[model samples]
Target: MTLHQQTTRRQFLQGTAAATAGLLVPFASRSFAFQSPNERPVFATIGLRNQGWGITNKSFKFADFAAFADVDANVLGENLEKAAQRQGKKPDGYKDYRKILDRDDIDAVMIATPDHWHTKIAVEAMLAGKDVYCEKPLTLTIDEGKLIEETVDKTGRVFQVGTMQRTESGQRFLQAVALIKNGRIGKVKKVTCGINGMQASPVIPEVKTPEGLDYDFWLGPAPKVAYRALPEMREGYGGGVPLYSNCHYSFRNWHEYSGGKLTDWGAHHVDIACWAIGASDTGPSRVTPLDYTLPVEYKEGYPVVDDQYNAATQFNIQVDMPNDIEMIITSEGDNGILFEGTEGRFFVNRGKITGKPVEDLESNPLPGGAIEEVYGGPVSENHTANFIDAMNSRKQPISDVWSHNRMLEICHLSNIAMRLGRAVNWDPAKREIVGDSQANTFLSREYRKGFEIDM
Candidate 1:
């Protein structure tokens, strides 16, 4: 079937399923025939970088790539060829992501752009009638999270945040939450999340923008600034680019584009911590920056120096969670979460879960379908599979925006507390800072001219 015909067929099937069952059926249990290319959902990916390519690469089995968009032409071309080889069909490419949203044939979009660009693209995509699967730390500021949440509710779209631990990580996190709920760790008291720290960089000089890269578009919604980089190349998983540049993988080290490790790793571990403790629906009462070391000086919350990484290099914060539970977020010790309660405690990360309680699980064992109960259904093949399932059911996926934003508020407040060198009070009900007006100003940002969200 042609692309248009295939889209129509899928819509008819979806509507039929909803009508027959009085609700959309989950993708796994539904007896829909989707073995052919024409039956797969049409998808496009924006921001062809480390995570942009990662999510799209995993989604190939469930969706057909109709297009790809990126501000850097070189990166776009390279990923297009890679995608074609993998799927045996070349997709159209564009530097502007809006062109992809303009296509009616596209059913959904996977946004893995920089933290600064996430909110704009995601909100616009949903407005254009497309489901979204955006990477975590979903918003640059707390206000942006509210904007995306409002848009999702307004558009009735299937939105999924890319916190794959909810679906992947070998279901270890699921088991961890299940254990907590089953009283394996009775009356949880304190939870520590050691997300680790990033290295401080030497002063990076301003350099000419690289060829085939649109520097202005890359800085969308962020303050306009000179492109900066050093000649030294990073030598690991996210290498080839300058190790100290304020772009690419190094963007995580700057406050303009990302929230450093606080929002980076914190998005993952803190999210799981809140879920296990039954605080996913609520917010913290206070966030105090006990100790932290910023790479550069800061007069207010804004950084003083423009060259070096400004985000906290090493830090520790104390968060007052609901029920008087104390949560410690620090960049020390092993990179994982340690959950301590009245009865027992355990440590969990992407690799393993260890503790006396975990050891006893082999003999005592969780009740049948315990993990599924936490997950709300049978686990899918991967995170992307869960997104596709949500698309079919028209239901929110495992990592919904509400829970993600609630946990992310802790991380955002931590950075704010560290920047101001004081504790900040948070009224979860109002979703705003209590008394500190200056600190509350950091909750939202002014967008660069011409790049503001149309909403």
Candidate 2:
């Protein structure tokens, strides 16, 4: 199976049709050369340490794994070896993702870097005429979310945010949403969102940078900080004290990288909450962060994780949307949604949707066609498969940048409100914070010189 040079559009469309029709469409086959039908949809991956590996591996048969990038040389070497074994050829490796975008041969990129790098790399990739599959929490800031949406429109590049939940049947999640949409809950009144507490990253002394790792590049747009090897000392979540690193996933604590449990997990649940309630197109008009009882001796600063994470360890954020529906997005209890309506109350998470409305789950009472419209319709194909389909279809994947960017902004707003400990008013149509200079400032961060996410 050599590269089918000069294949017609008709052939590509036919192949896509077959694949969509449930046939085994080969994305890449060993019999095919590096130039086969599979290779026609070229793809590269950056940040191939953990999630990147799985995302890249799934693209194995359908795309040519032509290039890989990571700031950590160790991660780069590992990914390169695995990609070579899978593709039957070595791929170009680099530390800077912008260089990967510079390659004319590559048509798409999978970005599995930390939450911070997603926006900058994706904007650049689109500008360079490459489609992008970026990880969730799509932007580090609400402003970056808007910038990404603008860039996607400007570049006309297909982008899929790694919100694979859209692809999942998420039976319980869908069921809960369906229950609300079908009126089983009787004019949904409020959503009580309970997320698990974020653990703190206790202070750890700085350590020498690991060999072959470009620590600076890993920091990327983040301000220059001394390197620390202890897991708690690292930036981003998942670890020690509640504020030093915020909770687990420390970056979620810092304004620069993530929105702690709020955006980290909220992106998923809130997205579901909005979907279930038929409110995805519009978000809450107001976001107020509930105060927390922090331990004494708290110090505040940008990249607050610098000394220790300071993102909300446990707080409730109320987002008031249209229709008197108040979304209580929080980390106040067990992680999930509790829907309290005029008629009944129900809760749902990855595990279950329980309460008086269990009958709705039993009967599937949601509106039949409503789910598709809210979740962007059938474009929500299998995550990896959708990427390949977009490659050949030349169409936006279901979880495209503009759609998810809205969600990202909402998530960011919740964090900003919580961080500032104030109510932040949003003009969703205008996508701006209303008359609050300080709140607006939280919408974007000051990037390290030479590392700003470009327009």
Candidate 3:
């Protein structure tokens, strides 16, 4: 396969300027090459809620919106109009995402569905001969990650998880990785990832499904349950729906659909931590839940209550990573990562990268192309740009499935350990729980009838 030429440092800086100006320089333009509008890839987005619309919105620069799909008609229609306004043309809309997959015109599908729906849609999209760019926390379980990885290998499709920190976020994360690899931090000893906790909701009541929203379809592979909500609308970020409900933005709080903060913010911070420490392709040997608090009671690793949030409320997990590294994932402290090494320590997050090593950059800076070297080549203008470039080159993007799943396994194990109230030993090579048949059952969930993946 022929690879696209890596972007030069000057070109990357220029592309960054274009991104800041709200105009993405086309991938071809970065190489002093031009692509006509018709040459852009065709894309259709599934699950057009908060993050569904977000990834699609950024992708408008590299791909044309051919259609949009969502279980909520209101969300579908809203994003359709938004896409038309931004792209100067209205794409089609559908309640069934499968309809988008059936279309031959769409070269790729951007999946921003809830965690439960990610594997099904992504696997089907790949089998249907379409590339995929799915959101982070890519799987709800370890088994789902394995299935997705297998499907990607079988189809040879380009799959990019929406972990934008690897490409964007002011390149602070990239700089952090480069600093670590350059011996600025010496041999890494301990890394703490501070992914904040979720608030336990006061008993949400089972309520009538809203108009134009297909509640059943939203539930999908998860167990059938009454739509629960309180008559209060959430305000910012992923607002508009009931803030305490088991649907929409609050879906992350339910174990049936997502894995709370362990997978929510853990997907971002843990992914970066693993990459910086050269542990992306491996896994932790033991996941010990030093301390944790689940919002509801559980029996046999299953939540007892159905009306309230069931995922972990706060947690402090210690994972024994490769190379005798100590990794502490906790809900306490500021929301960021702290890398402590033999020589020095540094803290980094989306907002800033600080400490002695970062301060030393003024006198002794990272070598030219350091960030690109850490990124495996020139970084694209944005994550979506990297996806598009991969589509053209037939290469996997920065946040590939193999690495994403490896790091995500730690988050998944942390949740499992907390749910079972015991540390779970893992065999990374076998990808299974050791000596705990009962605990191993959580690796894969049984899908609800008629919603199972039809591989």
- Give the whole-model CA lDDT for all candidates, comma-separated: 0.87, 0.67, 0.87
TM-score, cand. 1: 0.94
Q: How high a TM-score does candidate 3 get?
A: 0.94
Over 4 Å off, model 1: 1-35
Question: Residues 1-455, candidate 2, lDDT per residue (tens digit)?
Answer: 01231231112222211112111111211122244454456778988866788788877855777899988777788779988888889899998887888887777899988788888888888887877898887888877887887887787777888877665534456456556767777888888777666665566457666678787887788878776435434333321212232222344555546667766777777777776776767766888876653212333323334555556677767788789988776667677788889999987776655786775444553444444444343432258666656655667775676657666666788777655667889998988899888778777788899897675
Give one digit per residue, the lDDT tens place, for model 1 in 369-435: 6766888866666788778778877789999999999999999999999999999999999999999
Q: Compute the lDDT of residue 231 as modeled in candidate 1.
A: 91
User: Which candidate model has the greater lDDT, 2 or 3?
Assistant: 3
Q: How many clashes in candidate 2? A: 26
- TM-scores, one per candidate: 0.94, 0.82, 0.94
Candidate 3 lDDT over residue span 226-254, tens digit each? 99999988998888788789888899999
* CA displacement after TM-score superposition, residue 135 of candidate 1 (Å): 0.6
Better of 1 and 2 by TM-score: 1
